[model samples]
Target: MRTKPIRALATLAAMITISSTALLTGAADTHAADVHAEGTHAADIHTAAPPGLESLVDTAVTGYLKDDRIPGAAVTVVSGGKPVLTKGYGVADVRTRAPVDADRTGFFLGSLAKLFTAQSASQLVTEGRIDARADVNDHLREATVPDTRPGRPVTLDHLLTHTAGFDSDLVGRNKASAEDVEPLAEGLTTRRPPRVRAPGQVAAYDNYGYALAGQLVADVSGQDFPAYVDTRILRPLGMTHSTFAQPRPPRIAGQQARGYRPDGASGWTEAKGQYGSWSPAGPGAVSTAGDMGRWLTDQLTADSAANRLMRQVHYRQDPRLPGLGYGYEEWRRDGRTGWFKDGDIPGFHSTLLLLPAHDLGVFVVFNGDGTDGRAAVDGRNLIDRVVDHLVPARPATPEAPRPSADPALATYTGSYRAARVSRSSLMAVEGLVGAVTVEKDGDTGLRTTGLSVDPQHGEQRWTALGDGLFRERGAGGATLAFTGDGLLVSSATPATAYERLTWRQSPALHTALLGFGLAVAALGAIAYPATAAARHLRRRDPHPRAARAARAAAAVTGLLAVTFAASLAAVVSDANAMMEAVPLGSPLLTAVTVTGTALVVTTLGVATGAMAAWQRGWWNRTARVLFTLTALGCLALASMLLLYHLVTAPLTWITG
Candidate 1:
């Protein structure tokens, strides 16, 4: 018994040592995996975002990039007024194995740099150096505003407000180089007579107007517009990484992502779009997420005179739309207010959103213009989602639903709107599916999709907590709460909620449903004949049991073929619509059809031979081989489709 206890003790000690070794080894492997996952090969680097926010950030980015097959993307976010999340995802250059980084990622701010130009203009007003309403002519010597009426010469206010009636697509204004500028008067005449409404009658967003605004900065300050912004706006904010250099400055190195365009048949090919040095309104500035966060912090500092100046509602109406108010460069979207700007070009799509209401900001720069307007708009919504999560404190009654007596919901329900709203929150309790539509004229309409409210998700319903406040879902999968000021503020994360309703449609949606039905019918017609032929041969075969098996195989093969064909057709239709051409025979279509046909042929051979070979050894062997080949082929084709859909398909509306 003494000897037995000693043996037991020794065994216990050994187990302990083994357990410790296993844990240490496991830990080392995990650490190594993390490092490798985030390692930068020079073309792109992937790093973990700050904890808690990583899933949200990664999911959003992965979906956005994969859906568009973007070569790479750089992302960052601010939490607690500090850079909490800064990371790069995907390859910067596939051939080079280069890693993307915050410091080196190069993206066109496009028109988003307008916020900087506008901020600089606002700063001048704060310093008593410029007037928001002064005659732009006073600052001009070589260029003059095109006079549409004898006495109604466009004023500085008119240009700043985008109501100068200048054409937005001023192509010639963007010269071959940023150093080139078409004469201001020249840009006006080559186009139709200026469509000048009464000055300030409508707030039209014009690239040329912003370019003119940039020019005014130059004429008044006696400095190039790019230099003026760098000194007066960027440098003051300590944004060292932001620049508008014609050729990118040397300081920005290694981590920059190359811009690309979808080649006609070449697929995702590279291109260098216009870079601005002369035309400040359009594509000129290059920036990264870390630098942009610094700029946003400076813009949000209430103590700064620049912030106050920027908040001034100069035009008091959305220059881009009616009813929405314009404050210097920022826009007032109903009760919830924020500064918003977006950029788009051949190879890039970018956006910046500053929610002054909650001291929150989000900036996104994508490698491709895949989503067009929807990407920027959706990016802002994602920020709002993050903000909501950060804003609301846990309710005291944790396990209980928010009470009906909650005062916050009542205060939030008043007629509030954004210049461009996504959804109306009037029916906050009903969720999106059943929510009533509030028309432009403020009329209520029924939800055409029917009502769908699930309180369990906390995502699809308005959950009433205490204090009259309610948690509501935002467009970006974030939550928002009604503030006492009649604004929908993010409950946890920092965000501003706008009420744009342009995405809502009844007639267009109906047509889409009808198209889907037609597509399904067409697919069934194409597949039925193959299925019938296979089923008949199997049921009437020489061997009764084998015939039954063949019939089952036929049914499965026919179903699979039909489903694949329908999905392929839908993708082709969507691609055609986007490109404005029937892509009759592309490499993409060829790949899909070739793979599907191979499977069909293999299936037919196996099903026919299986029934014939029930008692014949030779036929059975052939049938078995065919079955194995068919199974292997299916797996290979699946792998190829996954790779193509996730990497190179330019317009994948189906997956998107």
Candidate 2:
């Protein structure tokens, strides 16, 4: 099995934030006004047509669906507080051949549900029920966020802006059914992730932080989190087709667009949807395009206290941009400001963008997970294309200071790790090996490698933008600035920051160490069988019992290596399949877990037998030394696996 990059659904949401920067690209001049056609939804309002908007949108969406082989999607565009276009493309149910209905179809909102949670929290603040800056623990009844830093309590503001400093943990939280889902308080307590940083100091996109916020909402509002959201936000906005319920409400239960994954050459396979115990933290919302349109419209035009509070800029992750404020991620360029939120889970992807300056909003939902080469149909990119068509970029402003070879630049040359990283599992290995290296480029420019996942094209050039800020040469409108606090900030996604690290803690060093260790283990495992066979052929066997024990150790060590390789292959080859299987229980997981346990036991046995052989002096020095080394190596390998959670018992409730 090839090692596939297995990302939890929570990680998928964080990835969306990184990818959203690409949405600002494309040529302008295509206006939504041109696509002025009323949708099937009775509430849709139409205005003057801009002539070519409809065709432009249709062409883009149709091409995306076909190219990516996505089964279905729904898009709603709102201009001047009215929905100008609401449309659905392709089948909602592949099995039933049901056509997607923009007004009726409910797609999982994924992390976008965080927007509602944020709104709920903000609403409480507006109603004087909760203070944005108050300690979150004051309102919690079921769980408590321990104070990692004295005098700095995790606040509603911190949670809203994703600066609560919680370490990322999704294991055993993404439950596939209501039965598996735990109550918000119990769930948070059970999977209570540690705060890795001081609250309000660093921005780390956290689903658990939002989950805590939901619990706060439930406690303060005296209503269930979902009920409060529905009554206060959804229903009040006339979003009747939307529900935050996990198993889904009866009214919209049958209307769900089944999530899908690519089935190799055989076409699409329906994916079992996931429900998290921290559903309110992110995920577990079902909504339609029409309902989303209404929600967007209210966001754009409503004067409600909660709506007003949601729009307020609370914390800016990037000093160069407006950054993340409250429930929405905000961006400003060329005098225009926009707020957006994106969501991604196993089988569903959604994005909501509101351009308050233009009084325009766009919502997109894809039923199929983009793992099947359909990532190009990104909701952010889709919205960006539409935005460009309607409100094109203004002329470029005067350039900032040119790059200069300042000797002081050496201070910036180092490795930086993403502020948000996987903790408490083997996934931490990724963070360990994924640091970005900044090196001085020709004269004035700097080159950054490993900032992106693409190893072949990882290097990005940056020219100084004054004030310790460096702007990417060809990033269009993106920028990266070095903060006084030894952090790197990106204008594109202000919700995430990167922390600079010392040489010893660099990703390059850790990656090299891991590679070297693995290589030695592989060589030893391979040489064991070859050496044994050669010895047997030569009839040189001595101390038969010890030899047999050595051979058994070698075989078990080889099996461990093979198991690790297979696990990685399973992840790389079909991550979605692996994700679906892990939460539901699968034979593959059983095999790997059982084999891993055996490897641990066998390794220990080898270590004990090798000690006995060394004490008894039953073999030649070379044979005893080799056996001792092999035993030690096996133990080390097993220990590494155990430390990384590789050999842990299979988790039936965790979904990637």
Which candidate tops TM-score?
Answer: 2
Tens-place lDDT digits, model 2, residues 94-203: 66667678889988887888888988888889889898898988888878887668888989899989898887755445666656666778888977777777888888
| lDDT (10s digit) by residue, model 1, range 553-576 | 544553554454443443333221
Q: After TM-score superposition, what is the CA distance of residue 449 in candidate 2 from its true location, in Å? A: 4.2
Cα misplacement distance, residue 281 of candidate 2 (Å): 2.2
- Candidate 2 Cα deviation (angstroms), residue 498: 1.6
Model 2 alpha-carbon miss at residue 509, Å: 3.7
Q: lDDT, candidate 1, residue 383?
A: 58
**TM-score, every prediction:** 0.52, 0.85
Stretches off by above 4 angstroms in model 2 are 1-45, 147-150, 333-335, 371-373, 399-406, 432-434, 449-459, 523-526, 529-541, 544-551, 578-643, 649-656
